[model samples]
Target: MSLPRYQEYKNSGVAWLGNIPRHWEAVFLKRVIKAIDSGVSVNSIDTPAEENELGVLKTSCVYRGEFDPSENKAVIPEEHDRLACPVRAGTVIVSRMNTPELVGAAGVVRQNIDNLFLPDRLWQVHFKDAVPAYVHYWCQTPIYRAQVQSACAGTSSSMQNLSQDEFRRFVLALPPIREQSAIATFLDRETAKIDGLIAQQEKLIALLAEKRQATISHAITKGLNPAAPMKDSGVAWLGEVPAHWRVGKIQNFAKRESGHTPSRQHPEWWENCTIPWFTLADVWQLRTDNVKFVYETKELVSELGLANSSARLLPAGTVMLSRTASVGYSAIMGCDMATTQDFINWVCKPELTSDFLLYVLRGMRTEFDRLMMGSTHQTIYMPDVAKLMMGLPPIEEQAFIVSFLDTEITRLDALTAEATRGIALLKERRSALISAAVTGKIDVRLS
Candidate 1:
């Protein structure tokens, strides 16, 4: 929908704030903000505090016009006294220190959070005349973000700081209180509608993923034949399989192999890097690219490195499953490659196909969740992994299952990609609407 423009406009002198409504003033934030209060840095646990306990807000608590109270850490009892500047209603919390992109992110609190306190990385804005919601909306605009990017100071690329003085000096294209309320109200309704649509797309994506996994799980375990007789597979998780299929330890069909990292202290071992090395860093590529076979990797090791280390150069078509840190993701090696110990490699014998083993690993998400252990770093230990059992289908059936899944997954992926694109367009619209309304590019009073 097209929005009506202000009848009259005047130059605001600021590059980002090119022009404003005739009556609106382009004023420094200090003129409208009473004070920017900061909370003390407190020793806190990683877990969120219970309702009865005091918590310190993490820098992540605020994002582009969004507030997440749950992104807080429980304050240690000894540091409870350090909890100052309790989260208050009608205040906008701005990130004073964070990664470059998120340094000046702001979110307005809708209600009083009595037990939650801000951290040093965030500043609580006390408005003197500005409406908190309107200011919060303004903060999300491209105009405000450009100023934030210019004002941020730090030597490091990863982290930047927005000082209270720099923030106070930033200009706002101020509107009358009533007009500010109107813009905020208009945004509240419009953005919520966009967000709701985005949510539906997200739900669709999730449902599609679940269906995809279920399809694979059923195909691998039950085979494509619906009328096939079934038998108990003895393993509790492998409930039942086709009557003709064999159920036994995966090691019986494939030779289980381990990988190792060459000593980093010996630079000579890492020299002349040539072999593709599969590590946790490359796992993200597999998931994001959604490729069944992994040919490329983030890092490569030298032949010198491999010869000295326990790492072995496995043949093409060998299956690799990440066993530590990032667990359960499996893929077939597209070429001869060595891997880091983070993976559990398998060289399939004549009886089992690498593709079939990969499917079994992918479809066993439930079983993976059950076997995984450790608090900080989850791992499927060697002993349990060695004894892992899977249904063994005939070679022809395995090939058919792989081919069927490839086609069905491709169809589902296309639908998911379309839904993802819808969400992205909705977000772009929401952002554009906010920028237009807040910067006086469009009048939202009657919108």
Candidate 2:
């Protein structure tokens, strides 16, 4: 997929800029930037009081190379000194503070957005003469990212702060402004086609997930033999089940428990802990495609932290469902682990196995979400969960259902994995195409 090169070439005397088309010039970003400054400093609130008041934009807005007014944090007053800075169409915004990979991510403002203020961690620049879209495309290049990474300074590994002076001096090869605009237009057309293909793959994944859940739900509620005698289960989500099936609240068969966090202020409680303490983030990792078991967590707690708090290490077979944010997500413990109060822990009885309960919870997520629709935050209260009725067959039949689902879902998972890889390759191709075009590796004026 290599593209045609320029008719003639000359070294730019810069390692990143490489050999530019002989007709073009390699210049510092500062040479084309008219004005560059950081945004205002303000405390951000999760949900803004109103949509119209001044809001602070997170670095993520620029990181994605798109302007999403919705990702703002509510700030009462965007001070005129820095916060009230007006944002106009064509302004190039780059994040001053982000992870090393995304620190210098930039995008152009395509429309006149209202009531949005920039944070001190983001920089909005106005080009003296260069096209905003052209500079934005440069920001997407590995060359630009490498320079940003080298200049980034940070005391902690998780965070990175971009050096403004060094970034402004970042070199890029440029063509005439008209050629730049043409190249940008060419990219807009090419990228839209790639994006369409990626979107189609995503929609397919969603459909496959729905089909998988339906299969699990049907099997869990009714025995594999459809001709089996049916009886009223007296539950909305689970309408009718096999006549011989037992129906009751989960608490009837499983021992329900929860965990807690130790006080952060007490060093003695957390300083030297070896216990795996699970958080909501850990639950999310376990929910990733093909992730079935959670053997460990992101953070560990001290023995004192476990003793002082309500945390209790559970056996490997215990099933946990997220009770707070990300409600209804469930996973089984692959090894001994403790969790926070955000989960409802279930120790399965001899009659109800962990695998059966896991599938049941996984299938009934839609019902849990429906029941909790009115709440400001989606959280399934423990009492409501305790009242959830599930139909259960004999232990042998339960094992059969679990085994069938395990094999069926794994087959579907493989197809999904293939589609996911295709999407990734498409995205990489998209980025590479853009990089080649903007760096003079390919001429798009004739595109």
In terms of lDDT, model 2 sits at 0.83
Per-model root-mean-square deviation over C-alphas:
1.6, 4.1
TM-score per candidate, in order?
0.96, 0.83
How does candidate 1 score on lDDT? 0.89
Per-residue lDDT tens digits of candidate 1, residues 59-99?
A: 88886468889999999999988689999999999998888
Candidate 1 lowest-lDDT run of ten = 283-292
Name model 2 segments beyond 4 Å from true: 37-58, 73-83, 114-119, 154-159, 257-285, 297-315, 324-327, 335-343, 370-381
The numbered model that scores best in TM-score is 1
Backbone clashes (count) for model 1: 0
lDDT of 2 by residue, 1-447 (tens): 445788998998887577989988999888998988667777767775365577788777875666666777777553434465656788888888877677788888888776777788888888877999888888888888888877875445788887768888888888999989998898888888999999999998888898888888999998788889999999989999999999999888899988788889998887877878889878676566356678878899887788888878888899888877777888888888899998888999999999999888888967887757435667887778778779988999999999999998998888788889989999899899989998888877776
Q: Best lDDT goes to which candidate?
A: 1
Q: What TM-score quantifies how close candidate 2 is to the native fold?
A: 0.83
Q: Residue 264 lDDT in model 1?
A: 95
lDDT of each: 0.89, 0.83
